[model samples]
Target: MRLSRAFQPTLKEVPSEAQIASHRLMLRAGLIRQTAAGIYAWLPAGLRVLRNIARIVREEQDAIGAQEVLMPTIQSADLWRRSGRYDAYGPEMLRLKDRHERELLYGPTNEEMITDLFGGAVKSYRELPQVLYQIQWKFRDEVRPRFGVMRGREFFMKDAYTFDADYEGAVKSYRRMMLAYLRTFQRLGVRAVPMVADTGPIGGNLSHEFLILAPTGESGVFYDAALEEQDWLSEPVDIDDSASLAAFFDKVTHFYAATDEKHDEAAWAEVPEGRRREGRGIEVGHIFYFGTKYSESMGISVSGPDGAPLYPEMGSYGIGVSRLVGAIIEASHDEAGLIWPDAVAPYKAAILNLKPGDSATDAVCERLYAAGAEIFLYDDRAERAGVKFNDADLMGHPWQMIVGPRGAKDGTVELKRRATGERFELSVEDALAKVLGA
Candidate 1:
């Protein structure tokens, strides 16, 4: 993408209202714009990042055997009524009325709706275990929606519901999701710790909130430092093997980890003095196992192996798809701007044309852009070298290819790593190999 033609409306001065780093940088980097309080219109650059995050979430979900399904944003109030949460959900629920004067709402979550849908279709123990997920927009009428997308009223979310015929099955489903969340956050380039958390509204005895460490976060987190060093993807987890899943869950939970709501001094005291870690963290994902909560409330029942009516045990797993954009910045950005993880960066690298029209520089940049056009954002704008450098840092592509007249004349370009400011001057082919993986 050429900067001259791109719709990135980057700002020079920080917006006064942006209280957090992600909010401030998101505005300055031209990723998103506020259309109203607690709501935003994701600009082209912002949408690209959002899509990238969603894609990773989708892949991880698919890897765990969760089938994707698109659910409606607008839901019938009657569904909530059946689940006995119509009046209980409170003001956050965006209630409305349609043309026929029927009670409606922009769904905050899909527990009841998914339960009803699956309940009607699957009738026996044979269809006992299934995970359905969707990446979609959700709205909650936050009384004070601030901090940009981090606390937006309207945002994108990935919500998955699991249906199982028995308590044992639900536990396996929960562990599978826990493993999936760990892998998802690891790939998103944030060390998100799974802490025992309060089941606010989700109504689950067993719940975990995946919180990423950040100085500016709202939640106080306490955990063993060992959790940060875990490479969850390195471990082979067989979702079909209950014993394997149980062992994986036990291995992780054995660590002393809890949010402020669940913190135990007794447990914390048992940890080695040097291993105990404390910090503020932002919650990016949550998993819950609320057995028969929706199924029983909504009268959703299936036949058991013994031919008796059974209420399916259920769980809901959620990843803040849009909020992650901001949370990632909160967890990963530096003074300059966002240092995007390669997996979720809108573009893998940027080609900075220090002299856009210089014959030699243009030739090198054109070759570089052509060689990795799919993964490169070509900065062909007629901007000053300093301006291109600042913008490239602000946008935070993982790699930056600098093409200047001196290097271009010699058929060479400078490759810079965005995260560490590491630089190398090499031939065009070498630069391409470094950025494009040969």
Candidate 2:
């Protein structure tokens, strides 16, 4: 995409209200704009990143046998009432009434709706093990929504629900989700540790919160240092093999990890001092096994093998999709701006025409752009070399191709790595090969 044609409203200076680095950078980069307190309108650039993250979430969910199905943002309040959470969910629930005077709500979560859907169609154990997910906007009226998208009242989330006929089947499904979450975060170039967490409003006996450590994070966490080095991608994960899933669970649980809500001082003391890590963390994902909490309450039952009526065991998994964009910045950014992971970066590389008006430089850039490279070409009408370079760096594309009259005269262009700040002069073909190969 050409910068001149793109709708990026980048600012020359940081906004005064943005206190944190991520918030400030997001505003200056024209990624998002606050429409109201705790709510935002994602601009073109921000929406690209959001879509990339959503793609990764979808890929990982599909890998674990979870099918995608979008649910409504507005759901009938009667469903929540059946789950006995209409009164219990508190003020965060955005309750309202339609023109017909029927109760409605913007769903904070979809347990009730999912249960109601499952109960209506599923009637036997043959459809026992089913997992469905959706990526959609969710709203919770936070009393104090701050820190940009990190704690926004209206945000995007990928929520998945699983229904199984037995306790053993439910546990296996939960482990598959845990592995999926690890793979999802890893692909996004972030190391998110799975820590035991409180069930909170989800109401479950088994739950885990995937946290990414950042100094400016909201929650305090205690975990083993070894978890930092573990490579989830290298681990053998077989979603259909229950034994493999159990082994993966055991490996992860061997370490001591817990959020403040579930922190055990005795367990922390047991770890060697060198292995103990206490720090702030941001919750990027959460999973829960709630047994028959929603199913039983909503009359979601199926026939067992013995011909007895059985309420399916259930679980829910969630990833804070919009919040992760801010969390990724918090976990990995320098003084300049965002250091986007290549997998989630809007553009793989940025082609900066340092001498935009120069005939030779334009020729080289034109050839490079024609070679099917995913890049943001800086070909603006009124930007200086320094301005173009700074904008490219601030946007954090993985690679930067700088073409100038000097380099064009020499039949070369400078290819720079955004993360390492290393530069090398190469022919147009060579540069294209290197950047696209990455």
Candidate 3:
């Protein structure tokens, strides 16, 4: 998008309301705007980033055999009541009454609703193992919502539900999702350590929270360094095999990782001194194997092999699609501005026209823009070179294709990699080849 004609409104001064790096930078860089306390209107660039993150999430979910489905944001309170959680869920759930005088609530999570839907559709054991997912907005009435999207009251999330016929099958589904989450984080260019966490209102003995290390995080983290060493994307675990999944699960969970709330100093000491890593962490995802919590409460069941009633074991997995935007910025920004990773950047590269009116610079930039206009953010604004440079850095595109009159005159462009601050002056052809991977 050309900055001159774009709706990207950048700020020179940080808003006082933004207390965190991601919050401040997001507003300053024109990624989002606060419409209400803890509620934001994602601007163009921000929406692009949000969609990119969601797309990655959807892809990863699909790879794990999860079928995509769209569930409602507003759930019937009756569903919660059926699950015996309407009163127990507390005020974070926005309970309300419709104009028809029927009770309803904005769903903070979808355990009860999904159980209702799945129960209504599948009655036989033929559909015993199924993973259904959705990328949708969720609401929680946080009394004090803060941290921008990181703790927003209404945010986009990817929640997947898994149903299995037996405890053993549920365990396999749970492990498969764990593997999927790790791979998803790796693809998003972040290392989110899976730590055993409390189930809370979700109500499951088995639960894990994926935390990204950041000083501004809400929880203190303790883990073995080896947990971060493995490349989950390359792991050879067969999702179809229970033994393989179990081995993978053991390989990961045995490494000793936990938040301060669950930290055991004895287990901490058992980790080799060299492998001990303690730091603050921001939660970006969570998974729970609640077994019969929802199915039993909602009276959801399918036929067993012998034709008796069976409550399908249930599990839910979630990745904070919107909060990840903030958590990623919290984990990866520098003094200049945000430093977006390649996979999740709104734009792969930015074309900065240092001399917008100058024919040579315009020619070079226009040529670069033509090469991949959709994938490039062309900063053709009539601004000073320094202004363009600063804005390019602030916007955090992975590559900056600097088009100055001097280089433009020789048909060369200065390409700078934003993450590493590495610059290379090359001919237009070479620059295009490098940035666009020609």
Candidate 4:
């Protein structure tokens, strides 16, 4: 995408309202704009990063056999009433009334609605195990929504629901999802520790919150450092095998990890002093095995093997697709600007034309742009070299292909790695190879 043609409205100074690094940089870098308090309109650049995150979330969900489905943002209040939560959910539910005077509410979550949908169609143990997921917008009337998308009132989220015929099967589903969540975060280039957490309104005895460590996080967390060493994806756990899934879950839970809300002094004392890690953490994802909470409340019953009526055990898994954008920035930015990891960067690399219209510079940039047009953000704006450089750093592309007049004349470009601030002057061919990781 060409900067000149893009609608990125980057700002020079930080907005006073942005209190956090992610919030300030998101505004200064032109990733998002506040349309209302606690709400934002994702600009083109921001949307690209969001879509990339969602894509990764979707791929990981699919790999775990979850089927994608679209659920409505506006849910019928009747659904919540059926689940006995209409009055219990509080004002954050966004209650409203349609023109017909019928009660309605924007869904903060979809447990009730999904239960009703599947309850009506799925009957019998034959349809015992299923996982349905959707990447959609959700709104919660946060009294004070700060930290940009990190705590936005309106944000995109990936929520998946799993249904199983029995408690044992539900446990299996939960373990599989735990594995998927760890792998997803790893691929996104962030270390999110899975910590035991409260279920809250979701109502489950077993729950885990994946928290990414950052200095500016919302809450303090305590965990064993060993949890950071496991590569979940490489572990030989077959999701189809319940025993394997249980073993994997045991392996992970064997480590001491908990947010401050659930921290246990006795357990903390058990850890070796050197392995103890305490830091601020921002929650990026959560999973809960609610068992029959939704199914029982909604009167969802399927036939058991003995032909007896049975309530399908349920679990819900969520990854903050939009909040991740802010979380990534919070966890990875430097003084210059954001430092996006290669896996989730909006653009893999950017071609910065130091002299946009200079014939030599233009030729070199055009050639580099042609080599990787699909994955490159070409800065063809008629801006100063410093302006281009600063903006490239602010946007945080994993690599910057700097095309200055001198290098352009020699058919060479300078490759700058965003994460390390390392620069290498190389011929156009070598630059292309390096950027492509060939």
Which candidate gets the maximum lDDT versus the true structure?
1
Q: Could you tell me which 10 consecutive residues in candidate 4 have the lowest summed lDDT?
A: 197-206
Residue-by-residue lDDT tens digits, candidate 2, 318-398: 999999999998877787777899888888888888877789988888887877545555554458888888888788888
Clashes of each: 0, 0, 0, 0
The residue-by-residue lDDT of candidate 4 on 1-438, one tens digit each, is: 888888889999989999999999999999899999899999888898999889889998999999999989999988898889999988787999999999988889999988898988998989879899999999999988988999999989999999998888888999999989988898899988889997776565589999988888887899999988876566577879988998888888889999887899999999999999998999999998888888988899999999999999899999999999999999999889999988888789989988767899999999988998889999998888889989999989999999989988899899999999899999999999998982
Model 4 regions more than 4 Å off: 201-205
Angstrom error of the Cα, residue 299, model 4: value is 0.6
Query: What are the models' TM-scores?
Result: 0.97, 0.97, 0.97, 0.97
Which model is ahead, 2 or 4, in terms of lDDT? Answer: 4
lDDT of 3 by residue, 174-274 (tens): 99999999889988989999998877765555789999989999999998888877755566888899889998888888788888877888888899999
Ranking by lDDT: 1, 3, 4, 2
Clashing pairs in 3: none
Give stretches of model 3 more than 4 Å off.
201-205
Error of 2 at 298 (Å): 1.1
